[model samples]
Target: MSGLVDKAKNYVAEKVANMEKPEACLSQVDFKGVNRECVTYGAKVSVKNPYNTAIPICEISYVLKSDARVIASGTIPDPGSIRGHETTVLDVPVKVAHSILVSLVKDIARDWDIDYQLDLGLTIDLPVIGNFTIPLSRKGEIKLPTLKDVFHKK
Candidate 1:
């Protein structure tokens, strides 16, 4: 009887391992806007659902790092749901304080941009599969707006 139970567990594990899972990627990160206190950047994430039913997103957590230092981190709860058989795009806003940018002047002066790594966790609830997290990471450089660009009239 114990052997039979062990075999059943192994079968279930194998099935789960072979199941179709959702996939996601960080598409782009760009400067969004600037406010009095901080500059905001938007990170775009594309998620593809493989199941036939819509999956509810549990949470989206993100960390923005530069020079191996965390510059922004936050969690977005219950952002929405991923459509079945289609791709959904989500936007995550990251705010970095003006003071923080000032501290990195040396790096900015060299290339007029900031190099960054964005780490994201996309959690979704799959039927009969519980909650699963799709981890994504992207590295790139974002060009900073020059004084003329900021003050230029549209």
Candidate 2:
């Protein structure tokens, strides 16, 4: 059980990291509302297991930071499942995705040079379902993107 928990945690972390990496930018971003800051991205995941067992539950959390201090925090508990015995990543949750995206947009929007109140929309894409064949096969450690990277313009 301990091993499974650790693997799950690591998996979530990696997914989140990859999703926000600079190189991972969505091919095209559509802005909405009067403010261009308002944007949305969507994601989905599928899972496959050898035994057809229900996908293990995953919990995700979002923490907003500023000046190295936490400004807001939220969590998505066992948002969804990857489906049992399926060999694909499942779409788990969206709230955390939205929170992170909104936080990023809001940060840049607050800049004096940028006059706007951002209302962000987000989508998370679940790529190939990881190989969870072995009890300890899954890795869960991820280096999260800093607030600046998520919100700042390069």
Candidate 3:
């Protein structure tokens, strides 16, 4: 009896492991806008849904780090649902406090850019599998807007 139960468990585990799952990737990151309080950046995420029906997005959480310090982190709930058998692009906005900019003087002095690592989790509710989270990460330098770019008169 125990041997039969073990075989059944193994079969279920193998089936779960071989199931086709959704895939996600960080497509791009760019500056969205700057306000008096903080700088806003947008991360474009692309998700490929393999199911035959739409899946509800539970949440999208993100972390932005620079100079080994966390610049911003937050959770965006219920961004939307992903279309069936198609790719969806979602924009995640991150706000960095104005006070934190002062702490990054070292990187600013080296270059007019910030070396950053963005970590994002795309969570979706899937049938049978329940909830699944796809973790995505991106590392690159984001150039700060120069005085000309910021103060340019239209």
Candidate 4:
């Protein structure tokens, strides 16, 4: 009986390992807004759902870092769902206080840009599979607005 159970477990494990699952990608991150006290950015997350049924997104958690310091991190609760057989784009917003950006003066002073790493976790509920999290990371540089950009008229 124990041997039979072990075979069943092994079979299930193999099937689960071969199962078709959803995939995610971090498409882009760009400046969204800027104010006197804080600078805000939006990360575009593209999730592709292969299942016929829609999968509910539990949350999107993100961390934005610069110069080895975490400038911003937070969660977006109930962020919505990945559409069935379709790709959905979700935006994750991050805001760094001016004080935090100011702390990276050395890095920002070089070439007038900030080198950054953005980490993201996308959690979704899969039928009969519990919750699965797709982890993604992106590294790039963002140029801060120049004085001319701030003062330029559209």
Top-TM-score structure, candidate number:
1
Root-mean-square deviation of Cα positions for candidate 3 versus the true structure, in angstroms? 2.0
**Cα shift from native, residue 98, model 2 (Å):** 12
Off by over 4 Å in 1: 147-154
Q: Each candidate's TM vs. the true structure?
A: 0.91, 0.28, 0.89, 0.90
**lDDT of each residue in 88-127, candidate 2, tens digit only:** 4433221223343445554545551212211212222234
lDDT of 1 by residue, 1-154 (tens): 9999999999998999899999998999998778798888999999999988889999999998888888889999999999989999999888889888888888899998889999999999987689999999999998887787667767
Compared with the true structure, model 1 gives a TM-score of: 0.91
User: In model 4, what lDDT does residue 69 have?
Assistant: 84
TM-score of structure candidate 3: 0.89
Cα lDDT of model 4 by residue, 38-101, tens digit: 8888889889999998999998898898888899999988888888999999989888898987
For candidate 4, give the lDDT of residue 95: 86
Candidate 3 local lDDT, 75-153, one digit each (tens): 9999999999999988999888879887998998898889999999998998877899999999998777777766766
The stretch of ten residues in a row with the least summed lDDT in candidate 2 is 21-30
Judging by lDDT, tell me the better candidate of 3 and 4: 3
Residue clash pairs of candidate 4: none
Compared with the true structure, the alpha-carbon lDDT of candidate 2 equals 0.35
Q: For model 3, give the 10-residue run with minimal summed lDDT.
A: 145-154
CA RMSD for every model?
1.8, 14.5, 2.0, 2.0
Relative to the true structure, how large is the alpha-carbon lDDT of every model?
0.90, 0.35, 0.90, 0.88
